[model samples]
Target: APDSPRALNGISLTIPDGQFLGIIGPNGSGKSTFGLCLSCLLRPSRGKIEVDGLDTSTPEKYWQIHKNVGMIFQNPDNQLVSTTVERELAFGLENLGFPSSEIQDRVDKALVQFDLTKYRKHAPHRLSGGQKQRLAIASVITMQPGLLICDEPTALLDPRSRAETLDLLYELHRGHNITVVYITQFPSEVLHMDRVIIMHRGAIVEDSNPRGVLSDIDLLERFNLDLPPTVKLADALRRRDVPLPAGIVEQEDLIQEMRDIPRGAPPGDHPESESARPDPTETVMELVDVDYTYSKDLPVSTPALHDVSMQITPGSFVGLVGSNGSGKSTLMQHLNGLLTPDSGRVLIEGEDLASKETDLTSIRQRVGLIFQFPEAQLFEETVFDDVAFGPRNLGMEGDELTDRVHDALQQVRLDPEYFSHRIPFNLSGGEKRRVAFAGILAMKPRYLVLDEPTAGLDAEGTHQIEDILTRFRDSGGTVLLVSHDMDLVATLADKVLVLD
Candidate 1:
């Protein structure tokens, strides 16, 4: 244990009161570790962290530090403990010993502010991914700490929800003067921060204002970080003699610059569309008038899917998109018989799922489904065991099993030598997702059903997922991807499916 690698090495930084800071980095770069140490959740190995003139390493100061600092974890499931959404918001307030009436008032305000009033009485676990994220933030904000540290809080949200969350954080920073430390993979999200810090290999690589750091395309590329689309477009244009000014990171700025340039005549002809491909004669998976309702016989039953029907042909990539709690996840679960339809039928390769002759084990082996949260599926002691679980269960062993795990980890861009022996729980959010993906990839499934596979991944990690999906499709495997990222879906999917 003494020889183990340090998550944060000789890190020294200071944050003045009411200053909003942003931190970005690639997967496993110790951003989350730094946040834990700052919040006193994790003690530093060799250095000291002080907040409000109080040392974090001092046990007597921990309570005061916790009282003034609140953290929203990357995984909402880890922070959520109450049975209901309303109770979750009040749990912290009650712990801090707020009066009964004041607790009720704060809970009501949080429920309304986060747009969770509709699901006030619903169980926290039963909420959708975005809903759970909102609950996590609400629970933390209800306590109203002076320093708020958010770790990729918007990774699971849809576009609208993402914008709303950013706006909310900005408002809190500007209005309440809360010292905010926001950690995210999206460079675009940090455009408004007072300062930005880039971390890699457990060290701060760059520290400067957002514009100064983000405008450096070469610097971001060196770290395997993603440049905003507008910034990339501007850089490409400038390279081709477009003469665009520097520091163009926002969409509006780019648009204004383009408007100032002289416009040429409209193009004479639009680009021709690609030729339409013929439909497949056989459907690999199909849902026929399927319907499902959770807690069907209970008084508080909730309907999920209604008369859903679709077909997935062999070797085709299909994109599924919808708002949170719009049955996207519920629909994905039906593909592999994880949840049977309350009415109608699910057919896998022409075999009815409800039929006694149909084997669910075979269906699962052919179709590998990755849940939205990687934490739900990862439980092994080490990364090697987790990735090897699927293959070993199918009778693989010895050198063959070892090779399968190694190859799978390599495919996800994680070095087998470095990650094999590490605990899966200790990895960053993006790393955990990749490990779960490696587990599914090791199974060699014919069909890959992924729900938000790239949710918490960085730019390089996302590109790797795109490459993997493309390779899978080219190799005669079918894919049904569920994601809120429209650009990704457009680039990878052959066809798109919308769920309302």
Candidate 2:
């Protein structure tokens, strides 16, 4: 165990009471490790952590520490233990021996606060990605812990849900004076934090106020951290001799600053040119009048897709966007026959997926699906085994299999030598996501169906994914990307589809 890598190396820091702290870093950079240690979920190998004068190293203080600290993991599925949404919120309170009346009150308020009142009886696992993220936040805040540690909590959420979750956390911090340790890959989210710390290779590289840290674009780029779009634009403008004011992190600030700047004459309008469209007859994948429903014959039956029809041409990159529970994920499941439409046809390369003779396994091999939660797709003991599973099943063996695994890991920016034998279950959230992606990449599918592939990934990780997708597309691979980030979609998608 001593030979294993140290997630945190001689980290020494102290937090004041009722402070809102933000942590940012590249993938596998120990942000999650630091949060785990602070919450007492993980014990430091050598250094001691004290919470409210109580030593976390002391066995007797573990209960007190746990009672005072609540953590929302990067993956919501990991923490959800109850069958129903309401029960999930009450599970922690019930464990703490709260009264039934108070638990009910807290659960009711949390459901309403998270906009999950109508789905209180629904299973947590059945909720949409954004809904599940909301439930995870609600479950923790319901317990009303003195300290809260959130590790990439907004990664799975839609834009509106992200805004709501951040507002709720801010309210909890300002109104209740709850100490919040927020770890995220999004640089803009740290704008309002009292302090921000940048981590790299298990060490704190930068610790300062939000503006001080964010304004250092070179430092952030060096750490593979993403800059806010507004900040990047402002930096570019400043470099071009524009007198943009400092601290332009938010869109509003940039807009206000631009309003004060002198404007040149408006450019003459030109007619927009339409690009040549692909032939509908030549398609890689297509859905015809598709309809799907959950619990079709049961009392709680809910329709997911209705008359949905779309054609994805070969080597095309299509972006799917919608609100929470808007059937984006359900539609994706139909692509590889994971979920067959009740009354429609799914065709892959002119072959109907519903045909009895069509080989589903072969289709799946050609169309790799990356789940929203990376953990769901990872089951093997080690990263090497998981990534190799796909290629190995395709009859690859020996050096060929090893080469595929190593190349896939490298494609995702993971060092195969360092991570190959490492257990995936023990890796950081971002690392797990990358491993899952590498697994899909090793499969070398002709069509890649990704559901929020960039979710929970750092800036460098995101760019790596973008590069992989571009290369894949250029090599004649089709990509069906489901995402909530408009900028990502706009930058990568050849066409965009909106689902209701």
Candidate 3:
């Protein structure tokens, strides 16, 4: 019998001291469930998990296992509970019955180590996404767990922030000799791991070194994951009969291959040297002299955007890239009048976006804004209820509502027959994301705006989402995406909009 459905199935693995392991899989492959079981966050129905020889089935042993294991969830907001950075760093110690003196000492040490001393007094919530993620790690580090498990900790962070968080984790692995178990879908991040394990349908499919695993292009495609850039480049070159290393997985390797190419060969003869083909008249989004600021009758409020002129157009996918606190979210909030500009104007169709009487609701209906972690917006009990909420809110009813809900479920790829009655909370992280997306799709919006929609998804989930968005565009729905995925932006966006 399968252990509890949320528990491991034929899953057996061990981490010797000082190992870095990266796990990859499609959504619902039980990667996170396995991690949770190991972390003692969830109990297995039949299988036993042991930490340093302590069986996890016993309450005392479970507690003991937790004392040595620390988990950082995908969302920093879910893990951070302290009002200030200093307190957040100290939270773990305080919970474990550490004395006040020791707790203070750990807090200071963690703050210094994480380079958060300057913001020790600042509220954690006010910190950038990356900063908040660092604080979450700092809080866990204060506990000094022997094994660290991070579940997609950088899923929704900006580029700089993501790099910083990865750097911090790598530092912890090298400096502290902490055994690291990381779950992620970002090929960029995975390439840096010492080892990678690929999971599919609740089982491990491939376990090898990072470079070796990613080089298996066939295996990656089988699991719905993309080859890393280096591997992809190598494969592309190979197809064109260019000489290159078989498992290239980084820029250095690609550069090495290129440098070794025949010195006198024409640039056009080498496929690797070929420039991107130019296309004529690609429509780009344009924003002209737009200014926006928040106000509430008080005089001290700060303006979020000022004279920000930009453009994004048809067949042109663009990224609104920025660090947290750099006004990325606020700017998107203005696209459909969720927040109106006080000065200047925004135009999508060369029409003003500031009129109070314009069918703003209809405008919202056109532009789908999936809030950051759309699960925050899910309120219904059953999957059906949750997905049906949006269309119903739009005044959809009777057979129309039913038909719309069914189509929406299909859009997110959730089987309405199996998932309709399941409680929203019972679904896995990937399932929850789909449910949330289904709610938005039920609205039948013309322009779609998403915020970190794939934060907790695995490689398969991410690919599915990208495909869905592509299809939506193909079906004539305009997309304005907000993501922490630079790779996705590079792969999908026709243009780039660096917000800060």
Candidate 4:
């Protein structure tokens, strides 16, 4: 028998009925595994899990326990198996032997509830990552289990969608008497939980009320987790001896506290002459009067982009932000010549992307676009082959191929020796995402366009990506990043394009 790694190590926790619990931790900290164990999807190596007085370990009680528990996985692709959105929503109901009328009614309600009516007949595999995530949550919640476990269900969602999903979870817990276990990386998402549990290395590191949990800054730092924006800024003011009171975690309170401080240079006051700006002559890519449509069949045709125009300057970081279906991903695809415009011009280095002589292959090589879902980028048998596939096509061999693959893995924090021969499909969701990015990095693109680049990354992994993007930009490369994290975009983007 193969010696598989232990997902949960001596883990124990008890949940009271009708309580809303929030679990927070860094990636690979056993959060997802813990969720799986509690939901009866994965039996623990040594511990027992029970739900609603039924033991999950007992085969006879399996259905009884499964009926009381529902789980939404972190990876949307892994959870979606039905051909269409509607079918996926009805899957659990059908498995529970619900009548046809009941299944249809629940599926119909879910379609409207999650804004999925438009995609009722669309295949889950063909949907965008954010869409699939929404579908996954909708499907599980429709089953109406007594205990719900969600593993980063909103990680791939845009800001508005994430808010809606969280609101729905709160409604289920507060209105429907559901015991909710919400697992997330974002500190703000867990601020309202009745109880908060911080996990590290398959063990509970901290268990306390949300108020007490949020007040401890040092604990968060030790675990490498990001603090809520207001908490972080409040800590900053305290560090500078500004006399700001401690434990201020809300934006309004933090702002009021700043107002009480003696008048001084405004928060961001700086010399106008030294302000940040990039040279206009450094434009590396440009889009003018672009328009694109998908699924030309009259019934399914959808216009993704319209009269969209933008320019990217070398050494500049650009953020593309919008709602879930607001053309952000479609625009990123255009940057790398993946999709030709229905009209207008995409100019990269002064060459028209639509021209037959422009060599689209070379343009794709120069402009790397990582999809919101990383699974699309992986196909080779091993991790090493996947990363090396890019350079290998460019005639790289021997030492050069070895160095490129190794460096790419290291850049993404994956141990080269340990992961080089491993199958890409066996890695965790976050690990798969990183390996995909590394594959693109090996190509050494001059202009990079990433869609939802930090979706599945943890606090530390996100920082590593930021560092890599900054280094690339500082080295005369241009990056057009598409992300829904407003704070991240505001902090790193030299320019922002907001689509309605």
* Top candidate, metric TM-score: 1
Candidate 3 local lDDT, 1-500, one digit each (tens):
34445334587777778888999887777778778877888877767778778887888777778889999987789888888788888778877899999999989998888778877877787666667777887899889888999888877677777787788888889999988899887765877778889887788878888877877888888887767767877787778777786777888878988898987644345345443524435443345676765443534344567778776565445566777556777778878777777666776555566765567777777778887778777778899888888778878889888888889999878888898989998787667888888888888887787776667666767777888887887676667777767778877776667776
What candidate 4 gets wrong by more than 4 Å, as runs, is 1-5, 256-278, 373-383, 406-434
- Supply candidate 1's per-residue lDDT for 434: 80
TM-score of each: 0.92, 0.91, 0.84, 0.91
lDDT of each: 0.90, 0.89, 0.77, 0.85
Ranking by TM-score: 1, 4, 2, 3
> Of 1 and 2, which scores higher on TM-score?
1
Candidates ranked by lDDT? 1, 2, 4, 3
Off by over 4 Å in 2: 1-3, 239-241, 265-281, 373-376, 379-385, 396-435
List model 4 lDDT by residue over 1-500, tens digit each.
24876556677789999999999988778998888878887776676787887877888987888888899987788889998789999999999999999999999999998999998878787676778889999999889999999888888888789888999999889899999998998877888889999998778999998867777898888898898888988897787667888878778888998888899765644456553555667568999999988865556567888998888777788898988778888888887688889998999998998898998889989998887777667999999999999899999999999999999888778899999999999887678888898899898889889888887677887887787777777777788989999878987887899986
Worst 10 residues of 2 by lDDT: 266-275
Candidate 1, residues 1-500: lDDT per residue as tens digits? 89988788788898989999999999888999999988999998797888889999999999999999999987799899998889899999998999999999999999899999988888898888888999999999999899999999999888889999999999999999999999998988898899999999899999999988888999999999999888998997887667689989889999999999888753354477883545677899999999998878875577889999999999889999998888999999998999999998899999898999999999998999988776568998999999999889989999999999999888778999999999999887667878888899899899999899888888887887898788878878899999988879988998999988
Candidate 1: residue 12 Cα off by (Å):
2.3
Best prediction by lDDT: 1
lDDT of 4 at 251: 82
